[model samples]
Target chain A: MQSENSSVNTEAKKIQTSKVPPSEGFREAFLLHLADTTLILTQRNGAWCGHGPILEQDIAITNITLDLIGQSRNFYQYAAKLINESSLAPSPVEKAGDEATEDSLAYLRTEREFKNLLLVEQENGDWAQTIVRQFLFSVYQYFLFEQLQNSKDDQLAAIAAKSLKEVTYHVSWSADWVIRLGDGTDESNERMQKAIAALWPYTGEMFMQADYEQGIISEIHLLKDRWIEKVKTVFEEATLAIPENIFMQSGGKNGVHTEKLGHILAEMQYLQRTNLGAKW
Target chain B: MQNINTDFKTNPINNKASQVPPEERFREAVFSLLEQVPDPEVPVLSILDLGIVRDVKVIDDKVEIIITPTYSGCPAMDAISMDIRFKLIEYGYKNIKITQVLTPVWTTDWMTENGKKKLLEYGIAPPKRSTNNEDEMPKCPQCKSANTKLLSQFGSTACKALYQCNDCKEPFDYFKCH
Candidate 1:
């Protein structure tokens, strides 16, 4: 009787361990993805701080960048919390047991760990190109956040709800500029078309959901596909044609980004890396 | 009894009309004086008019003013904070504390009815509540027309957007709902 009870107890333990769900790790990865995109884009937009095409536009773009930075901070903070709770290990391990705080997680991560899409890191080309890039990105972001507001995760839903309002304005602003440049004069329209053609390749990366996103969708019931449909509808209304070129480029999700990201990181991490433990 | 009478008689009303405690009067004065501080973005509107000032408190001979920024990242927030400090100092309040409250997030819904009326009169559309339902349309500030179209979501400031009135053919700025 004692031997049989011991065997049964061992079997129960095995089943209990096996029954535990696999670590979704979705929330952590999603937060990092959002943070990387916002942080990099904020840095790019910050370059236009003093040198906008016009005074009003300069102020507008800078203001938008500030909003992005604020959003990035909030998202990164939430991501840090998620990371602390998740069982997933950090990639390209360097320092073991070095707990990452929100600030450290944002500032300390190496280049390969970032998961931003390549488009956000692309060079700002010219003023027209920048507007087009922003327009395209904002439209997608607005739609994405709109759907994300209903996410089962309360924190993510709250962030999405707040950011959706801001993204709506951002999209509208970019859309206006797109239409103005697209429908304006021969030179303006030509430039607008050129910008669109240049940025067309990067659009595919925004919609590509990988295993991390898929896991989250299955576990948390997140609405990732809905965001894509909403984006498509907006694109249709904007009188813009979706690029049919099936040859898509994607690497940012895997932390393989363009060369520009290296330089961006150098600038962003200089102070933090050089002066470790320094407080402003 | 003699001491209590002395205290009551020492009240400003008994000694001189202007010698009252000045707590209530000072608060009223500060309210009016601060009303002159215009919103950095929309100069035509006062900070009080926009409802950014949340509370005014006086305790232990110190003045505490609470304010909320229109947007979290608004550059105007720093300017507004500085402006409040300077204005209070200028008003002879030696110990003034300006506290910023970030929760409850500032929304255009805080704007006074008169403030909204003024915004429309100034050709700027007042903000409308954001709705998840799909049937709502933003009205134009100039013509009060529902036929207006959103020209762009981004406006001159983080808090506004550019919209065009189809009826009047005028382009106006819409104060965005936070």
Candidate 2:
């Protein structure tokens, strides 16, 4: 792994010297939204790596984390290229002497510049909360990836097509847990209900359109009802009640985030920040 | 039909000539050489057996191999790609290129019949064909019993499921078909 990190030094330098003008469009923001959301959530999910309720469950969650992070790597790599080819942002486009490698884009960005969802940034409180958060996000991702798989953009379509299968498994696995714990003992049911109430407010932002999503508005709107229907089915099967008429939290898509995101970045980026350009 | 026969009779050697184009012959040679490269995870199965090798092209004496990973985070892909390059180099093929494609996402259904047989023989149950019931339990490769229960949705790797046979009381891995 150390050798692998060092091996990219040459390519990284080449990327820096090739000063391609940033591509102009909403695509860079859209790609960052996908990449940041997954990357931030991956760090949060990594908190559960060795602390799962059981060995198998721990392994399962860790695998989920790996999958999410891998997906983020793909998005970040694509986003970095788009950022290089265009002049779109205050982020990933670095100051003098600094190049925006995927690692730099991920580790060096400030919290104010990140465009992830608040729901993913919120702390993983408990196993129930974690499961609930995963379920809600996976439901949205399922719908999003379904449409993305057929995207006119070939690279996005290819990435989505590969990621869709893995995310499908994530949806099923998390939904199964939701159903089991929701219908289990009274204590477990109570916890699941609480997690749902706390997390439901953040889910609304998933459907709320960001400026970058303007191009995909109608495409996203087409899948909104299906996402709702899918979540509704799982909640019903889980014997959990849904909260209605509640306010939904927003603004994470616009670079505003919960305070939790800063702490997550502090911890996840600590090594990279402290040891700048250090391999492995 | 008469025209076709007459054409063949006029240049009878043409059947042998056109049947194997130079490109096709080179492709066959590349495939045969690639067969020596086994999957990083399941060393018994070749990349062809794992269905990751999507295409093998030889153009102007240069070789290009196309591959797809089983999963997005599959750790074996990098190793497998490196192994392919190394083996090709060892086989004296210069100017080798390995391209990774994600479109038309890979499925376990692409695993060859011989691959499945090898997996079962190696004590790993191959993924079953797509069925409406996702909960369908795979037969235990150890005891050939259908009364196996899933121990974990995830196993040693992302692409496998852990199962334990009730009768034989043995744990095994099932290569989950995506």
Off by over 4 Å in 2: A1-23, A87-93, A97-99, A219-221, B1-23, B131-135
Against the true structure, what is each candidate's TM-score? 0.65, 0.87
Stretches of candidate 1 exceeding 4 Å from the true structure: A1-24, A84-102, A218-240, A277-280, B1-69, B75-106, B114-156, B161-174
User: Can you write out model 2's per-residue Cα lDDT over A177-278, one digit (the tens) per residue?
Assistant: 999999999999999999999998998898888877765433455466778888899999999988999899999999988788889889888988898877
lDDT of 1 by residue, A21-140 (tens): 324776677788888898899999989988998766887788788788777866787787667665667632216565556568767888898998888988888888889778777876
Cα-based lDDT for every prediction: 0.71, 0.81
Best candidate according to lDDT: 2
Query: How does chain B score by TM in each prediction?
Result: 0.80, 0.87
What lDDT tens digits, residue by residue, belong to model 2 across residues B11-68? 1111245567877777787898789999888888999998999998766666778888
Ten contiguous residues minimizing lDDT sum, candidate 2 chain A: A13-22
lDDT, candidate 2, at B73:
76
Ten contiguous residues minimizing lDDT sum, candidate 1 chain A: A13-22
The TM-score of candidate 1's chain A against the true chain A comes to 0.82
